[model samples]
Target: MTGSLRGILCVLLSAASPAALRRAFMRRQDEQRKGGPTMWRLRTLASMILLGILGILLATVLIGGILDVRLSRATLDHQYEERARIAASTVADIPEIRTAVLDGDRNRIIQPLAQRLIAGTGASYIVVTDRDGLRFSHPNPQQIGRRLEEPVSVLDGRSHVGIDHGSLGQSANGKAPIVDGRGRVVGQVSVGILENQVAHQLDEEIEAIALYSAIALAAGAAVAMLLTRAVKRVTFGLELREIASLLQEREAMLHGIREGVIGMDAKGRVNLVNDEARRLLGITANAIGQQLDELVPAGRLRRVLAGRDAGADLSVLTDDALLVANHRPVVVGGRPIGSIVTLRDRTELEALIRRMHAVTGLSNALRAQEHEFTNRLHVLVGLLDLGETDEARQYLADLASDQLISAEDLRSRIGPPVVAALVLAKLAVAAESDVDLSVTADSHLDAPAADAQTLMTIIGNLIDNALDAVSAQSGPRRVTLQLRDDDHHVRMVVSDNGPGISAEAVEEIFTDGYSTKSPRGEMRRGMGLALVRRLVYRRNGTIDVSPGPGARFEIRLPLSSLDPVASARTEVSEESR
Candidate 1:
């Protein structure tokens, strides 16, 4: 129903003048970009409502007056016809009139009686006629003893009422028969009231009806005005066109943004969701008006969306995307209304950052190697200049043995080339930071699982976190990593010995956006462990934090089949080779 109304309003608004349309279009765009207040110069809603009400009242008055006039005329005709019948019946029953008519003296006695009756009963005329239709009495004395043109209608001894065109004028007329002592019809009596007299009475009634109608119309107009004021107040005095333009701007803004937007009521029901939100959350448009618990599964995402776990830049891992969300509470008139949450997809950005870090680490290692070689060459040249040939030979032997042993040991211990490279880079970074970072002697692993990216994220974040933890502490900072793989599962343990984690921070450290470190410019903190937890959980793995002298994290993941994309890439690379 609401959609249909909006469509109708759109059609009507489109039919407006072209200049108005252009103005409205420009205003809508400005509001969407800068959120300016609405200004409408068109007809106000109050005026339209007032005009409509007045038109209705006018039409009602005209129709009602016409109907009232017709009904009043009908009533007057019936009433006067009945009055004439009664008068004629009274004259016919008089004994004097009967005797006068019987004696053929109607012309002498009845004419004066008829004149008296015409004055008393308000009739136009009274006529008395014999059985042969010869008029014995009439309003005109000259016509009294003349014969009537028509036959006596009441010769059957019955009373009759109808309209008559007599000598006086058209009138409501009635007739009755006068009987003798033998019960035989002797004569006829007729009475009539003029149509003009009935018309005068109808005019008086019409005046009264019109007065009442005017009073009702005035009352209706007053009520309509009051109602219009109330409606205007409710709408904040916005014209119909302004309201429609705001609606259009709202729709365009909500759908045009790249960030996902969700609006919820105070009761935690979703009231609005933009297209980006629906797509990022893997939900349909039907999610609107549903509770957060219903739209999203029970997890960190649902908790963050419901404002149960409130924070800015909180990271949530959905089924297919990693999202950063910010929650802001909405207030209106100093009362809590609801909240709005904005989401950004960081999956691609995070991947790029990781690759950049890897490249940076490789460059750092090369630089370190070049510096060490240059120092060694300086020593060799000095030894040669001092003529200590035997000492230089022993120094070369020591350097060669040290480099070959370390490289051979790491390659034999870690079978995957990527993992070996990652450890070597971390070792160089650890040396640069004056921290002892090493792999356990018993650590052993086969080639990586097909989902190597997941492994890299988990291993990289854990190792970097351990390094950061120790870098800030004094004295001997040490970090250790152990990896093991079997037919069914892979296991990892990373522990650092610096200022160890406090008991209170054991569970909190894994929460998104909760960091012990100070904030960096524009960069979010404390998302690493949150990402690890989500990935491990998704793969049906278990992770536990043991009581720590330094922080110790242990994880075990069940092995799975190769990733299709990774497998395809490997096949293509092998064919090229």
Candidate 2:
């Protein structure tokens, strides 16, 4: 249960612990079965990344190989064409070959020369033709005297290079014109290399291209594998499906829980804040990725969240809520990561406790009154037994006048019924304790303050502290409470004739969790004066304490109200100014 609770509560990197990741993986596997085999079929994020990179590299290699093959073929053709052109032009420029072709008996001389050049230069064949389109020399000697069936290309006396279908086979062929000394075109020289030879050259280039491409593909695959490993480590070896599932679960758990949860990084940046946290902290804007101090106001709340003020169930007073916060630091792999602070709103619970305290006080007052009534009855019974009727009657008259005189006076002076009841209860308690507790005659309250609860808290805490102060005294004990109300503010004063706060203790009295009193069970002390001070200041009020032979505390809290007439007049006056 502890492990699961920590997993659900903390959103730091620790959330990706091995156990949690395994659970997430199991959940993903179940989801995959439900969704079908195609869902997250790759299983691991690293495998998927590797496969994607390999696929891309494979496609790139294939496309590149095709383009390279095309380019190689074109280059081979150009090379062959250039070779044929050079061979034909060289033979045409020869005075012997040109004279022999023009003489019309060139087979004897040209056939041997063409064969020799073919052996040396690797030309497939060379054909000499006159202007009349008659072949002078051919690789086939039987066709040496035959006129060429095709028209003679030198009729225009220009050289040409292109594919040719000859008796030998299709080849890259170039034709060059042979001219006499008068510069008149007489015949043509054709030189060619077989298509098979060109294809052979192209095949060699394709082999090299394929080898290079394979190497590139291999390098790319290696890189992809290394990249995948890095990503896997970073993601804590969780698959994509697992990560998504964890995120969904985290969101559900974070916002679903009633307690406010805040997750911060080691650097004091807010990484996660749930809906309840936002509502409890009164944070309206997005807080993720923001600095903790920037989002939370500088106070006990911020200090606690930032781990500066550390403790369990540390009470934090916010603008409108009283919160009990517990800060837990999260460490992963023995390294400090960050922390998670859970805030539970204690405002309502604290209010109920205070109300219960009021009821308890009133109950004690009733008990005290009952005890006093019993003693009076005993006196009356004793007087009747002694036969002193006039004395008994007079005693009854005095008891009737004194009975509830303080209650009547309190009701007349205090306006709010709750405050009146609380004070009356305290009065009875003080009387029972043999301490003099009185409300000043000059004290009066017209109505309740706007934030009467805060007002009551301030007054109540002061009075309680005063009673505690007086309770320690050996001699006469007195506690005085004075309340004054006006249109703008409510003032309260509580003083006691007891051992006053020492000069050193007075300075620290209003510090949270700083109590001089002995520990009482599990009850936390020192918050009362601190809380009273906070409430007074929050209401733009002032509190003054006099270190006592007896302690005296005075508080004045401003009343918040809207008067349209006064507001409008003030605005007009400001405009004129």
Candidate 3:
């Protein structure tokens, strides 16, 4: 028992031993990191799984063997018992045996009959006995005429059957009384089968049982090993505890971030929508399992959520917010199985970009002015070198006068210096493009300084687009900019006398990717109008384009109720000038 138990321990330890050693090694290195690398190597997991299969196989074999022995013993006992009973009954009813018992003769009758019956049936013993339980016939000739000392049930003159130990050895036995001619009990007949013979028969049954049990155990273990391998593949050989920890961390990280995140399944249904995503789209938790079309109803955002293509850096405008969004498909094994979308607020970023573009335009205007001044200086020096001092002075005077008149006209018509600077910069841009740029006399504004980018983004894109439209015209390539402000609203108009927009483009002109010019080498085209519409919509403003010989765009935005400090500052700046 001790040796067997030690062997089983060896097998169990063989499976668990490698992982235990690895874990100890990892602990020795724990000071370097919070935890050591995992011990869930392919070999260690295999050993563990094999050990489990071995335990199951051992259990099945042991239980099956025990049951097989008990059942085989029972079957053998019942079979031999019935055989002895039938043989004994046949002998008792024989006519020769009955006559011999009445005549008290064995040599002439019972001896031959007992010998013949034993030969035909292969019973271990067949004997005749008188009423006193004395044997008249026996298979061993030397045992003839001997008195049987053991108790016999047939001696009571009734049939009997049971297991009994006699001179023949332990056997299943049956006894019956032989009758005289008067139908009286005269003597007895006994038949028995040796227990050794029954045991040998049971041995064969056990061997067969062991064979089948071994086959079934091997099949079961093989199935278990295959299943273990499949599990390892699916989990990438990670332990259950490790996998569970990662899942928890993933959930917390996804939900903890401030940016909106949305996850969709292959069928384009919402699978994961974090709190920020829910708030951004104005949907509830019930949005999960809904189609993307149902969650994002707007045109631009819907295209992104539907995963129409691999989207990148898209702009989306909701009811009151502007967002920069990115959408991408989640691919696995070279197949697109899902999608992820991320979003962030872009109001501040757009404002910053607006200011940068305004500064850049102003710098370009200054460079152009510098170049023009250098040319005038060269011409004035030439006039003086030719001894035309009077002509040179008049030229300088004329240049100064023109600069003053332009500045005065801009200062009077535009109240804000930034707006005047933007207009002046655009006029230089128009001059570089060889187009006539004009500001109407009625232009006027008294907006706060903080609203400069808002106005710049709206007017800059329009003016730049208008300049491009008339830059290549054959005849009068002209553009007009008009700005007006009142207590309630601010309005602007940009009209260009270039080749007019076709009626077919009116419906889709403000949509993304809509452009009349063929993009030969440009990185971007047609995004200007879309951005204009998004900015206008976010601020609750209105824009309209009237069809004409050229394009005419008009915009109106609500004037904020000015605070006392801001109103005072505006007046002070105006009074200081």
Candidate 4:
């Protein structure tokens, strides 16, 4: 009886313990949910308030300082000009001053006039000198009756105003000739003023400006404080923690996604960058509060931020690695607020795509050859079935002769089998279409720098295009193929006598999905020129199309631009052979 009762008590205790532990776990989770947002909201609100204050203060101070300096300079210049004009006009009105020196009386007339001029103007000094060579009167009485060599301007009867350091230290002076009514120059009246006086005036104006600027700054700062307080009064009462948590959760959702996320404020400052964004940019740390350009270096990111929806791949090289960035603007309520940028590592994908294109091009060429072979076989069979042995033999002979002539011509001019085969294939097609095709190739192209497969594709596409262009002409259907190889590069030019391509179409012919042919046409379908352009770019080559009397497509590829590893492997295989 005792053992059974003890067993029942133990069972009851185990059942209660499980239920209590579950309740405790749920309570802990609830607490975490509540606390996380509260902390984040506080931080976000604080950051926003601080940043907004800093931006407003900086703009206000900068603009105010600039205005103050301009105002001060203008006021000082106005006062200085007024004072100089007044001094010049007062000296001009004294007839006694002019006559004493004009008559060349050395001692009797000049001294009293100089003293009177200085007293009336309250200037630093006045000096009167005769035109010949004598100082008749001077502020310093001892200097009177002395032989004077005046400045050249005074001797030339021209007035001069300048800052000078004479025997009397630094001074500014205005010198004018006392002229007679006949405009004949007499002696000179020299009025000197201290440089300190002008400087003092400027300083006074600057001081007034400074005082007013200080008052305005104080008022502006007070207003700013009041506004800040008002904003705080409204915002501080909010549940900052809850709002911050929601923002953090939203940001987390963005970061967790495969796409890169970036946000900027109105001041062009980066406010948010997710982990995926950092990784995409090859950045290891946070990029907040930094200029987007400083972090991205490529202006692509900045352009997206400036309300531009540039949906194109951007190649960016950071300190750590290269990135292919896709940038777009982030608009709120139909206005651009910031931007979103997505980055992808396209290096491997691009390399793979290039290889695939090369393989696919080779496959297509082989398929075309196979199709032609089947048609030739059918023609040969029909010739034999007609029971005309002699005619069949003659037809066979002529066919063999045409092939030999074409192949021999191509071999003599273009040495490589791949290029020769491409040219021969296009020649066959052009002959069937009744287009006159001419082939001119350099001897060096016998062993071209490009791989056999690449040479076939490049040459094949060009000749095919030329044949197609000439096929539509009603006149002499002529197509010319010229291949030249220099020490550094290979150049191919394919020209046709067909109605030339339009000037406007030439620029966009290489663009993807841009076709000149009708939608129902089967011959000119698919991404032909677009593929050509991609292949050319992958091989570090360039292609240009021009419309002259006829259509001309020029292709240039540097021998050294070939992939080094691929070239090395080919060289090794050739050496082994």
Candidate 5:
């Protein structure tokens, strides 16, 4: 039965006009669209206002009802008191009542006459009493001759009106004195009106107050609805879900990227700084909503944010990290919104680029050597084709001898093929760069100092740097390399006749991103020397630079096991001298 009843109710509702139902559906959709903060605040405000109005109306009604009840009771009490007094006065003036009370006769006078008076006046009770506070008559037969519940007020020579309890419960009662011809009071007559009729009028007043309060509540609700509609109009119609989705998308995009991103509003506050940005700049989480200049002081970043400075490839150095930043203004609707700063780490990329440069240098050097060897072969071919067989033979013999000497020289100097190859490669690179690479005669190493790769990196970077140093010099650009190895140590010295390093800069040259080679308006160097220092130190080596007319760098590496270079050293000293 319950299911069938529910089905019938659903069908009845669904059978309503389609247009009306469609309008209701559209209204619900519209409410959902405009249901974000503006509508929420509207609902809250309207509810509060409506509640306040209803509360005030109810309070007023309650107070009025209480006051009306009290006033009506007072009025009814006054009327009943007047009625009781009039009845008591009239009864006391009656000859029979006066005679009944004075005679104290229950059967013939006081009781029977009091009953007649109560019946005629519609009073709750009527009583006749003597001046000595003894009752002559009462409605209850058992108390017909008993003394009155309270002392007689008429005995004090005054009429009395009051509310008191008696046999018929509580009532408004009035007492009057009965006097004889000589004006001496003999007895008293009392009349009472029930309290219920007085209070019944107060109930009517309360009911009227309740009805008015309900009407006021309904009116207040209508006003609240009007105000709510006004608030809905002010909201510009945005769905709560749409706003949330937009906020969530913004948060996800800002946090998902690896690059550091910072956003500033038009008020110069950091409004959208992300985790990566905080990590890069050493900024704390509380930097949000703080002044941008306070978080990242007035510097390159500040200038970039302002219109005074702008660049896509600008580099900024923070507390510990070097950031390559791209900054641009965020414009919207032909108006400037704010600005966004995108930062990428440049120190790692610089290291990678420097390593690639070394590899390319090695390849270029090999190509140069290959070309030189081909030219030599062409010369031998030309000699043989000219029918100068003997000259060709001598040339070939001299070439073989030179090759043998070069091989022996390499063997005598550094026996390790990787070190030899690196040196040969650097030689071509230096030549191509228009710098003369001179290997001093005193340089000799019978074995490898450390790993070939380590030595290659150390020697390659130093030679490249030395070559760079001399490239700026005007005349006879020259770099000298010296190597010496013994049982305990392998030493390398690379010097150049260039402008040389400053005393102050030499100490800082090996620090990451601290470059002495600053090009015109560029900031991408100094990683090579830092790499060289790191590799040398890893093998427990020492590197030093001598302050001179040209820069000279010396490094000494501890060898695990090395052959003696004393004999070769003596021969090299003699030959050079």
Candidate 6:
């Protein structure tokens, strides 16, 4: 009956739906309070109540299984004790049991009594033994009187149950107590119950409990699955919306970033390239899943993929155009998986750098000229003090006459007043230093088409350098300036008769802040040649300084490239000056 009640409780707990259980519990509470449920409260309260019920049901099942096993053990023990007491009472009543056992007599009556005790009680084996360690009767007896090897506790009037090998050498329970006719200590009567009997009963109870637990567990699992599914269904849309918004924000940020960003996968295939990356690469096709080299055939992209740390601003030329690229490895899990390559157009930057260099070169050359001119002035003063007044005066007058003629000649040919005046002033300075400075031009001086400041800077530096070079010489200082117009270009040449520049220094003479003049000399620190080179490059002109018998600087520029109005006005003003 108790088993049936337990089974029913297990079924009820297992079969109860989470919602039904929750509603049943809430209904009881509501009835006690005389209150009704609200829609919102019902939804939240239902889940909590269901979980609480499930927890209680699970704990109850576990505890019941343990209690059931313990109760079954206790009932088995009680049955065993009652049977043992009855056997003891029956054995005590045997008239010859005590006499035969105590007197060590093995009689037929005691044998039948032992057999009857075994058969009636359904014990595996029965033994009757005396206090003299003699087995008077046994279930299996080769001889009626055999000495028992068991300890005296069973024969000493104490009841005990335990496993032992019987007289026939088979496993059995030796449970029995010895009593005399007056209930004093005497021989023992033992009955062995088979071990399988208790094991079988316990097994049946355990199996029932396990079956009940399995059903309960299955029902709980089903309820949990249903609850999870319902909750997912209710919140799935909101989660998806949040995920979509997050993705959009990520894309927006990537697009808005200024640096060219290219994401590559583990296989070195381009996974994503932002808009700025496309613009930098000058490619419109989607780059996803494509090898980086395919989109931009430059070898730099391949180098990046090979796990090389291509430093920032690395220059590479693609199709004869230079690009500055920065390559960086994309690391994941402490391993280089791919790379990111960013590039910028460097054409204009290179051009500007060249212009700056040109300006610097010109500035240095001008400074060298100034230094030499100072030396020339010192030489003239020395010449006068050495009592060579006539020689100095003749040299001075000849220089003045040459300057006047060159100025008139240049003013008449080159029409620009500013350019012509500058030329005349340079010539006069040359003459005063006993340097021959002449301008031989077939066409008028043209206004600079590009930056006027750059043109003046270029022309001033070349003429001044020539004058300084010649001034340092002991012989007649000679300088020639030639400006002529070709079909497509304008050419200017300035040559001096002083010591020529060394071949090695010619190349680097135009470098900014480089000067061959000694710092101890009267020349200013490096600036003139650098400025000259910069101006020439700015005006789209090329100037080359070479070592001949003396220093010679040649400049060439495209005439058509010049601003027409400026060129025309320059010519007109030179002629007027």
Q: Clashing residue pairs, candidate 2?
A: none
TM-score each candidate. Answer: 0.63, 0.68, 0.53, 0.41, 0.46, 0.31
Please write out the lDDT profile of model 2 over residues 531-571, one tens digit for every residue. 77765664478888888688888888666622223334322
Clashing residue pairs in candidate 4 are: 37-241, 38-241, 41-240, 41-244, 415-446
lDDT of predicted model 1: 0.76
Output the lDDT of residue 207, model 1: 90
What overall lDDT goes with each candidate model? 0.76, 0.76, 0.71, 0.60, 0.69, 0.60
Candidate 2: residue 571 Cα off by (Å): 29
Worst 10 residues of 6 by lDDT: 6-15
- The superposed Cα distance between candidate 1 and the true structure at residue 242, in angstroms, equals 8.5
Rank candidates, TM-score, best first: 2, 1, 3, 5, 4, 6
Clashing pairs in 3: none
Worst 10 residues of 5 by lDDT: 568-577
Relative to the true structure, candidate 1 reaches a TM of 0.63
Candidate 3 wrong stretches, greater than 4 Å: 1-43, 80-108, 127-167, 170-191, 239-252, 260-308, 311-577
Segments of candidate 5 deviating more than 4 angstroms:
1-246, 261-341, 345-371, 444-449, 485-490, 514-523, 534-541, 557-577
Give lDDT tens digits, candidate 4, residues 430-544. 6666788887644347445456555555666667667766776687899888887777777778888878888877866665435565542212232356556655676688898
Give the Cα error of residue 336 in candidate 6, in Å.
3.1
Q: Residues 208-258, candidate 3, lDDT per residue (tens digit)?
A: 888888888888888878867755443334454444444454467667888
Worst 10 residues of 1 by lDDT: 568-577
Q: How many angstroms is residue 432 displaced in model 1 relative to the true structure, after the best TM-score fit? A: 2.9
lDDT winner between candidates 2 and 5: 2
Provide the clashing-pair count of each candidate structure: 0, 0, 0, 5, 0, 38
Model 6 lDDT per residue over 314-342, tens place: 54433323355666654422444455556
